[model samples]
Target: MTSTTDIKAIIRRHRTRDAAFAVLGMVCLLVCIATLMALLVDLAIDGVGRLSPGFLTSFPSRFPGKAGILSAWVGTILVMLVTALAAVPLGVAAGIYLEEYARKNWLTTIIEINIANLAGVPSIVYGLMALGLFVYQFHLGQSILTAGLTLALLILPIVIIATRESIRAIPGSIREAAYALGATKWQAIKHHVLPYSTGGILTGVIIGLSRAIGESAPLITIGALTFIAFLPPAPVQRTFPFVNFDWLASPFTVMPIQLFNWVSRPQQAFHLNAAAAGLVLMAMTLAMNGIAIYVRYHSRKRIKW
Candidate 1:
């Protein structure tokens, strides 16, 4: 039989180790929170004053005091439009096919492995590929469409993985019940799978877009201009069609590139502009994440399962 002192010693050692780990985890969490708070505070101090209406409406100018993000933000919106339009349908469709329809085989296995690998591929590699495929071979030029397509490619794997995972989370019993009710496979997926997974899919899509928005490396490699004062042609026309597509082929710059331009300038005032632009970017990212969280929460609440 074990002595009472030995049992007490073992218990004391385990408790000591557990407390040490708890303290270590808390320290790491505090360090991360402190660093992020410090950066945000610094940005607010330097840039909050510059976020005025005029700053939003005006275009980039040589004079830092007069410069704004009109073109940058507009370009960002339009490019995001293209990215979503290109990525969502394709990614979702591919995911559905792989997860629901495709037979277990070598080909499917290879495709899955490749997609998982692609998700981790560096962004600059995508830029170079887009430069050759879209710009040279397709003659698309360094335009908004090219930029959008490049980012779409970069995030396609992310969307596909999210789609598959979300769909997989639904119980197989649900699908079987639909089938037992004489529902077609398509009907079951459409009526049940899609609705249940919409929240997760949207979260992934927005998260991917958020990452794409802040990326400057791929855009730069694809020849995005660093300085732009002119807006692309308006996407609405006053004529019979009442819609315009010229903006797709036009030159553009995003907020990150614009901020980079300002930061590169010698003047101290431009640094302030850079800080302001950084603030706006951070706000936009946060807003996207907030929307994702809100949607996910509501969606999960509605799911009885």
Candidate 2:
């Protein structure tokens, strides 16, 4: 009878503790939501009125009223295009080689450790490295190409890590089954592994690109221009048979650089402009993350394994 009473007391204590933890978790989630809500509200109230067509189409000016995100946004798109092109293939390939092909050797272990360590390095360090390699050695000269390469280096570890984790999550049985079917290693990876892992790969890609979009430190470290009023020339010329690569070498400014310019200014108007730009940047990041979530959800749903 005493033991039964003790068991009941223990159950009561556990239930009480669980209930307290549940409430605490809810409180923490609510606080986070509340904070996000407050920020969005502040941004909307301060900047929503400024999101006009003219604001999207005009260039930066000495006067805040005339300043727009035209050059900034355009430069951002061009640089990101370069980064995605350069990083995605290399990152995915490296991940595949490490997870699928590499043996349990010391060199493989060293490479894995180095990649993990690289992921933690500051973005500014990548910028300095780019400043030496791309800017000085390669003589890319603070162009869009240089910035893209720098951002690519900054996010490569992230992509590789994400891809490796995604690939590792697949069951070993799947690989064995592929081998039993007389499939070569390359065929197995191409047909079975890649199809199943595409969702995860894309999720990683979007996440990396999102990070690339918001990075200011690396770009600034490589001497990205802060004040720019003119647009880079079009990638295509108006003349006959005209496809141009010249814009890749042109001077550029990204949105974050422009935002920094605004926030650093003494004028009240530029501060408002900064708020608007912040909203735009936040929207771009959220859009990419949303896409990643959707891809991951569908991928998990389709592949029960």
The candidate that wins on TM-score is: 1
lDDT by residue for model 1 (1-305), tens: 88999999999999999999999999999999999999999999999989999998999998889999999999999999999999999999998999899999999999999998998899999999999999999999999999999999999998999899889989999999999999999999999899889998998898888888898889999999988889999999899699899999999999999999999989999999999999999999999989888988887888887
Local distance difference test, per candidate? 0.93, 0.92
Instruction: Spell out the clash pairs found in candidate 2.
Output: none
Please list the residue runs of candidate 2 whose C-alpha ends up more than 4 Å from where it truly belongs after superposition. Answer: 1-28, 238-242
lDDT assessment of candidate 2: 0.92
In candidate 1 the C-alpha lDDT for residue 151 amounts to: 94
**TM-score of model 1 relative to the true fold?**
0.93
What 10-residue stretch in candidate 2 is worst by lDDT?
43-52
